[model samples]
Target: MNKLRQHSFLAFLCLILILPTLVFGECTCDEEEDGDRNKTEALKYKLAAIASILVASAIGVGIPILGKTIPALHPDRNIFFLIKAFAAGVILATGFIHVLPDAFDNLTSPCLKENPWGKFPFTGFVAMVAAIGTLMVDASATSYYSRSHSKNNQAQPVENGGDEEKAGEHEGHVHVHTHATHGHSHGSVDTSPTTQLLRHRVISQVLELGIIVHSVIIGISLGASESPDTIRPLVAALTFHQFFEGMGLGGCISQAKFKARGVAIMALFFSLTTPVGIAIGIGISNVYKENSPTALIVEGVFNAASAGILIYMSLVDLLAADFMNPKMQSNGRLQAGANIALLLGAGCMSLLAKWA
Candidate 1:
């Protein structure tokens, strides 16, 4: 009889433990149905985001590169400097305000295991490594190209060299006088201009790589989301984000002076990347869980790396190069104007983070 009583108590204990799960399972099913309803509403916004981003990207890129035909937007103009300052500020804020914080959030998310992710600051570590990698690429590419250029220049015959040198020198002298008449000098155009132009090309390519990485990820996140309220504001904010970012990239592309075909291809590529990513996200949304462990790790690392690349490029390649230009330094008014423009651009981008 005593043994029978013990069995009854054991069964009751099991019942008590299992009852909450049975009730909670029903609640979970209800929540899942509500989530589905919300997700269905969000689908409409994804379509809108595609169109908005495509148009915004095209217009933004086209404006600067095509605007080259405009007198004020010429590379030599004070207006161009201000435009670059604005663009640099945008890129800077993108790294700091947008991508970096996102990285921190994802890497430190509770979904991740606490053993490694919580124990170590992986986001920062990845970012620092990424920054160093970018510097290596920048330095190595510049060195390799510089060496190749010097070799090619050396390989030319004296006869060809003499004629080319004469022509190059004439062009350089003309450039100096032209800038001088505009109240500044572009430094020695004979040698530095060629090297500078090459560097610009490198910068454009690397900057695009960094920007594209984040762009695709952002698009995917947007596509995978099932919240209309989350996506709605992102649509507007990302639109502006792409627009200003395109301007930054366009500035570099314009300065690089790539062939018309190259520019067209690049512009198209940039415009398409995010939209394509969105399409991919939509396809995989059924299985794509944003807060899942694998997704968080991948997206977090990529975002951190991208942030590092942009920060490095903006500071070292874009802002520093222009701010230290002889022309900008010579004119105090221009310097002050550019500084204000930079602040305005950064402030605007930072504000967008609240919604995006």
Candidate 2:
């Protein structure tokens, strides 16, 4: 394990050092003198993007969480499933339409050499590996927590068992209570609400990680651009993008039932990440060339990995789990409604890709 950690750290360091050299072909650093009007327009768009995305994200997340107060939006209702299906579709579209395409464009840019870079499909490969890695982490974490919980439960007798055992002792019938206790233990081992809740928590955290990575990268790109034309359309598109993405994340976080503090932290973090990335980009814009080999490689790799994680989580954890549930399967009308909602979400998000 130690060796594995060491190797992983070394690989990360090497990537950081080597990314700048991936292409020596050309740098699209246009040094054209833009008049003060252009500068003012760019600043206007940048601020607009920041404020719009921030408000959109906050409203998106807040709606779902606050929806708990509305009976119609309760998790147990069919409407909730439809909402979740829509959110899952948005996430699926984001991974496939937004992040994956960006990854491919970056890795296959004309600026890169045709030797080794063009020889292999790094974008697809990285995405595949990242998806498999997420599965492994998901499986391992679930197993570890389940096993630990089982062991802890075993170490302590059930509350009912203690009362039954005491009665059995008083009545000189300990064997009867022992047998009943065994049956209860078997049932507890088979299924538990705590275990299910823990799994949701894990899914929520991993999903947030994937979403935040892509969000920050997009923000940086938007911030670094000096082109007012490019920034103009992006501001509107990314506002909608952040809003939909936040809804997806909010659903997961609501299901996870995190503490008040945890929910606040996550919502704030999601709301602030894009703005923070933009801030970082503005600060480094003088040296941050978007077309630079380092920027391309890092952004491409991260985007690909994020795509994989989001896709897997959307398909396996969110959509499949809900679609296959007894509640959904039993109600054909509900299922059909959810399917339509899913398509609508995917279509809306896909359309945004045209500009973003």
Candidate 3:
């Protein structure tokens, strides 16, 4: 047993030391002004990617919001379960296959000093901590909202004993209104909307964190690179990636039942943040070093945190919530279909990791 533990510790330490070496190994010292000159050509193709992503995001997010118009897409239907499962799979793959791997690379890079980093796996550790933090936020926020909503229901005060019977009857139908309308369900009618909204809000905020962290890191790397050939394919890949990610996030926001203004604001934030990061990267390219110790550490820590939040949100709030629901459990065929869709979603996203 002692031998096994020691072997595990040494193996883990080796991974920590080796991984970051790969990430920072790609670094090239400062480039010339000609690097900026290459930007004009790169800009032209990137616009296409940006446009494609924006359109995809709009469509993905808007589709889920139209449950009223699309009967088959309604939350109660078996098809809706399949779609949510597929989405959850995509999110899970994003966290595990894409984001987590990238975080490991960032922290383990050769650019950073070896003494302390070589001793421990801070990348995985940070991700674990971040995931825990997100859970706390999700649970505490939901509890607070439920408590506030409970107060509101109590203050309404039943007008008469006759209305009391009506209230009881209305409560019976609350179950029907739940699962079909909100992304989440609550045991008590008073806490339903609050619980549902809190999850959506938490999802939107955390998803943004993941995308934003990756965007800035990639943007800086792109800005520092002099090779137009490398940047060309990345522009296309990242655009598609951003679009799909935005769609997943948008779908969650729509189901969250936020007001129209709130919805638009969130969608806009997701849309604009990456481009803004890219622009910032362009501005700071002179001072920015893709191989710098400080840059690697900052980017690694943030990426690890984002990966943790995204992984947890995808698995717990997105996948588990729907897959384990009574609705899914009651239907055997739907569960099978959803399982296939989940694999497809995860597989498709994992393929993208090759380029972007």
Candidate that scores best on lDDT: 1
Winner of 1 and 3 under lDDT = 1
Deviating ranges (above 4 Å) for candidate 2: 1-35, 160-191
lDDT of 3 by residue, 278-308 (tens): 6676677668777788888888888888889
Instruction: Give candidate 2's error at residue 118 in angstroms.
Output: 0.5
Q: Could you say which candidate leads in TM-score?
A: 1
Writing each residue's lDDT as its tens digit, candidate 1 over 1-356 gives 99999999999999999999887756778898988888888888999999999999988877779657987778888988898899899999999999999999999999999999999999888888988999999878877886676566556454535454454454331223334555766565433776787788899999999999999999999998888989999999999999999998999999889999999988998888888888888989999999899999999999999999999999999999999998999999999999999999999999999999
Give the per-residue lDDT of model 2 (tens digit) for 215-249: 99998988888789989999999998889888888
What is candidate 3's CA lDDT for residue 58? 59
lDDT of residue 239 for candidate 3: 63
Q: Weakest 10 consecutive residues, lDDT, candidate 1?
A: 170-179
Q: Model 1: runs farther than 4 Å from truth?
A: 1-37, 158-164, 169-191
Q: Model 3: C-alpha RMSD to truth?
A: 12.2
Per-model CA lDDT versus the true structure: 0.87, 0.84, 0.70
CA shift at 142, candidate 3, in angstroms? 0.7
Candidate 1, after superposition: displacement of residue 306 in Å? 0.5
Ranking by lDDT: 1, 2, 3
What's the best-to-worst order under TM-score?
1, 2, 3
- Candidate 1 global lDDT: 0.87
**In candidate 1, how many Å is residue 93 off?**
0.5
